[model samples]
Target: MGADLIVEVALRHDRSEWSRIVPELCGGDAELEALVRALLAHYDRPDSPLPEGPYPVTLGPFTLDRELGAGAHGKVYLARRASLDGFVALKLLRPGPGMSEFVEQVRREAGRARRIPSAHVVPVFDAGRIEGGPFYVEMAVCADPDEESPGSIRIGRSLREAQPGLDPGEAARLVEDLARAVHAAHRTGIVHGDVKPENVLLTPETHRVMLADFGIATSLAVSVAPESAPIGTVAYMAPEQWRDRRAPSPSSDVYTLGGTLYFLLSGVAPHAGREVGADAPPRPLPASVPPRLREIVQRALAPRPEDRPASAAALADELRRFRALEPTWHDRRSVSRRVLLFARRHARELAAVAVVLALLLPLFVAGYRFFAGRVGELAAGEARLHGRIQTLDRSRADLERDVARLEGAAESKQKELARTESRLQQLPRLEQALGAAKEEAARSEAALAQRDAEAREAALRVAALEAQVAAVREALADAQSRERAAREDGATREAVARQDAGRALGERDEARRRLSDAEARLRTLERELRERDAALAVARAAEREALRRAAALAPAPGTK
Candidate 1:
């Protein structure tokens, strides 16, 4: 039957059978949903396979890697922070090309991104809309990077690929810190929808485990999903999550937490029982697991929800008590760790024979007695190293909390922001002033060009006027001589002709005075232009210096 047929038959059935199949039917597994819907639509028509999912999404500074795994909402990728070398898991929406719902989710995430401050919870770094879907970038974290069946970080290096050697004792501390991190989130009124071993990851150094994949996380106890119930990993699902359906609830997280611990301790999921849907309980790994821890694990894994620990806090607290006990498993892990290191360090001497001898039963006993002092030192070193790892975990947690708070403070820009913004407004105005100064300098240069043209024209006119005055003087001299000659002739003819010559001399004097006045005006105008050019040069130098200062202050955005 088609999935539509299956759903209609299953949901609208006589009430008794409806009760049986409903639990298995409703949940968000986006990848599975996409594939199943693709397959179901084609069962009658075998020409089609489910079309491949949408292409990889690139949102600003992050790149989505392959699908890490999926749940009720859908498949998620272990995203790398391409902007900064960090790790984050990105979850895409299920059942949509319509983006209003994705945008709604972005708004909810934007709010949580502003509010929460816990390291174990993957920090949401930035968000925006992308290609008919909404995507968010997050603070990337470290991972084992190769997970086949999901939720397994390799136990030893060769058994796991490129795994770092971390003291198991320290690894235990990290898990504890992760619990505290979730508890911190709970304090802020948020519930991580998915909490399981796969979601928990250690750093490159293996000092801490960061929580990932909050695709279905909710800030409120209520959210819009099918029937107000069953919106998380089924294997890790708490009974209340399935029964009453109040997820993002503490009880729901408590169920998942128990399931997580069960996977960690046993290396096989108690619910899945070594394979999907097996009835047998998986036995604990022989020497790797501590026994008393197993008893507490059994309590947390009780078939009924009410029978389990009330919250993650209680489960973490019980685990803490087990941690305080002196475990022979951790000691053995320490011994094996040293043997590897020793073999590597003293390769020239302990190359082939001693390594084989060390493995022998007699030398194993003899070597412990022989290198008793060295063993003691190595144990002390491991203890100190564990302390350093804890310190790093605390530091990382504090940094994440600080980042979350800063993102919140940035959104609504309070008093400090207002003051900073007021100062910042001056920057652009100053920049505009600098730009205007540059333009003014250019105008001044053009003005200088005009002034030079005017000066040249004035100088040419002065020269012309001087030439005209000289010509007039020459003509006046000729006229005076002629007048003198005329007077001479008149003396011979009639005696005094002085009035015409005196008038000609006076006109020549007037022309000389006018020429001197024009020269003086030209000198004054040239002097004024030179001063203006000097001032423009000074203004340009100041503007260049101001631009340099703005460049220095560019990257730091708010309150810097």
Candidate 2:
């Protein structure tokens, strides 16, 4: 029998009737009759139980093609609108006793999402009741809905599937974008009561973040009533929010943003409690997060709302500055803190400056002493030259006195000879005596000639002494000029030394910072090692107990 004919006969007859009419339908063909009987028996059996919960074929104007995900109260489905050209994410509220209220909440969420105009906020297209079942809301899909095998695309899922947490810079940029979106909603008198990684979607191509799931968002213009309990994820909820169930505000959203950023940086939540103690320390961020950025996150996650940034926009601005390496509010507030942070960052440079200064100081001292000694030598040479010039002047004066004395003696002798010549004319008989007198006069002329030779020699000596004195004066002037030039050179060298010393001081500071960091790291490692050793001791004790138990339970001797 043909499959179509067998299916038709099985649908038309009951089990007992099919058993009785199979032979007649087959027309005496054994194989055809058996096949028809088997098909009839299979069609008579009851169908398997339907799969769980509101498996709708279509919702409103959209066809539910495949389930993207499901949660406690709702299920998200990949769907296509009847009149629309592209696919959309359709979230359906599960059918229950209080589904009407749930549907209204979803409508309110959609309204809130539609009011905000932000690229980071997911847009709601439409929402309505599904024929006779639960309600559905249509949203813009984050990824290519037509692509095959679209994997987990939410921020939480993506992070779980990756090896390391997101980079600090990238995480800051992403959170900044999200903060702007939250701020936009806040400006319209809306507060997203629940902001977490799971509700944040990511586009595959651009990796841009999109905020979704505003199920509990409240509008400040309408009411400020507190909920019975916290309305957001406990780990991400602000302390005041869960502690008193206070009305949600923009600051509460800022706390959640900080928690999300913490998750992105450390791959773990900052704290476990809904109402963590003020003194309780938060989980340390990874070393990858710079100190400035870490401080920003900590401030945003402050226990009290007043301690956090005033608004999500302000937080975004802080993160933007951090990403761009610009000084943040924390940095600008305290000069000392900024200097410390700078030193920590540039430790190596500061250390190098210190080394240079240490080396330059001694050289500067030695150069000063050397220049001082040269100046003293120049001063001493000037004093010696002055003394020599004074002595030469005294010698010239004494020679002039001796020449005057010699001229006086010669003039007196000439007068005496004139008187003797007049007396000899009166007495011509003593001619012989006149000859003797002439001889005496010739001896005196010889003596005068010798005295003139001595005078000429003394004049030459005085002239030579004057020339030596002049030369000494010129040498003294040159020495003074050289001393001035040396002093200037020393000043220049001192200036250069000071500059080098400054650079060295900077280097030394940098080195000290690096050493401090290294010591801190070593201390941390030691603490971790101690903890590991304690754990190992406990494990060894457990192993010993287990071995003893095993021995006690063993079969006696060789009784196997």
Candidate 3:
């Protein structure tokens, strides 16, 4: 049975009822039963002793130092390779029952991420399986460059965790940088199945974007599981992805990139805490967002995949163009000022053009008079020139329309700047509140650490008690066995003693009977001797007697 079933059973039932629960889930597999028990043991008490093997132990060439994070399938550890100089992130698939496929998944994650050679993508260094252990991938650790300390390691934080509420322009630039990285992945024939704020990492000082977590990366040509549940974050998922209708493509990544931008601008995801609707329109951006940026985001978050940007590269290009025009949008100069500046900057060129026109004026008059007689022949040429002038007029009108739109945008930008300044005015108060929150968080962390230490100690005590109880149980079992054997031995000895006593009694009775008969015979012989003496006495009295009887008895004795 799968370990998931065992875990589910353990969680669903009361802890006291696991005795009845896990055995059934294990299906009589002793190893599975023990494994689930160990898993639950560790789950309940992290400090509890593990089975025969655990991490912080060596796997192949890397010695796992500590667990950095864990997910359903595996754990990431900060590890040091024996032959390597720096630390690497080692992602190892957790070994358990029914996890054979997960091993291949980890291998594929490493393979796909390793193939995309982009600075924005976390580089995979190596991947292998430990003999009789687990599969692991070694990759470069993304750490905060700002927090770097000599002879110490720094862990990187994801963009959402580290920095939120970015300015609209910064958000656009960040997403643009990441889009280029996504484009690079697509070029390498890999589609990052999951792209959200969490997957994007930013180096603190430089704000460098590092797109990570290719664990769910799929082929650019087709999705590996198109009919499955949406493979990406729901808030940023494209409509087609939500429907699971087709393979995730570069356009899907662009859609998520737009969602990321939306989040940065509004401090909330585009569709946070909601399911994707079949006919949902793109959410309107905040008023503070520039029209150009909003347009870009809305286009990327199009309901139909085809309606969105064709590729991540195209999305990046749009953002690039927006950034290029951003300065002009922020410029507060009126149209008149721009015209005057243009004129001032080109005065020399304008003077040269005027001098050329002056030199050509007389020639033009002479030519017009000379050609007056041929005016009928030049009618077709004049009509062509008139058509060209009309086209130029239309072009000038279009330019005027563009200028008016830009003027409106510039006014909106000024209002946005005012709002920004007003927010900046409250910075000190916000900083104070932030300081208070950090202090409270520090206190909470300290309290939590104490509680954690106490919990660990309690776990140790409980484990000790359990060990003692087990020892007592074993001793009780041994004593009971000894007691049973002793009772059996005593009963056998009693039975033999009874048999011997009965035989001795019978022999004694026989001896007593024989003695009684011999005594009876002796008594009878005595009586006969006495009677013969009495008769001899009576015969002796008739004559001279008693003496005679005695003499007769003596003579008889002599004759005999």
Clashes of each: 9, 17, 1
Sliding window of 10 residues with minimal summed lDDT for model 1: 154-163
The local lDDT score (0 to 100) that residue 55 gets in candidate 2 is 46
Give the per-residue lDDT digits (tens) of candidate 1, residues 403-515: 55544433332333344335434534644654575475456434434444334434454344445444544543454454345334423321111222223233444433533
Query: Which stretches of candidate 1 lie above 4 Å from their native place?
Result: 1-89, 97-99, 126-128, 133-139, 143-171, 215-225, 273-288, 303-310, 326-560
Stretches of candidate 2 off by over 4 Å are: 1-60, 144-165, 215-227, 273-281, 336-560
What TM-score, computed on C-alpha atoms, does each candidate reach?
Answer: 0.39, 0.47, 0.46
Question: How far in Å is the alpha carbon of 27 misplaced in model 2?
Answer: 61
Show where candidate 3 strays beyond 4 Å. Answer: 1-75, 92-98, 126-136, 144-148, 215-227, 275-282, 326-560
Q: Sort by TM-score, best first.
A: 2, 3, 1
Per residue, candidate 3 scores C-alpha lDDT tens digits across 441-553 of: 44543443444433453445434433543454454344345434434443443343334334433344443353344335434433543543344333223223222322323
| Tens digits of per-residue lDDT for model 2, 1-560 | 55335545555556567666677777788988866555545445454121233544655677766676665556777677889866678877543232334455567777867888788887877665665345566787767332454543331223223316467887888889999999998987778887877678766557678887654334211222234755676777787866777766889999999988888888876656434544244688878788899999999999999999999999999998787655688988988877776776678899999999899989988998998998899889989988998998997787667545434433443343344335324333333443453354345334433443344544444344334434533443443354345445434533443343334323444433543443464354446435544543443344344334333333344342
- Say which prediction, candidate 1 or candidate 2, comes out ahead on lDDT: 2
Top TM-score hit: 2
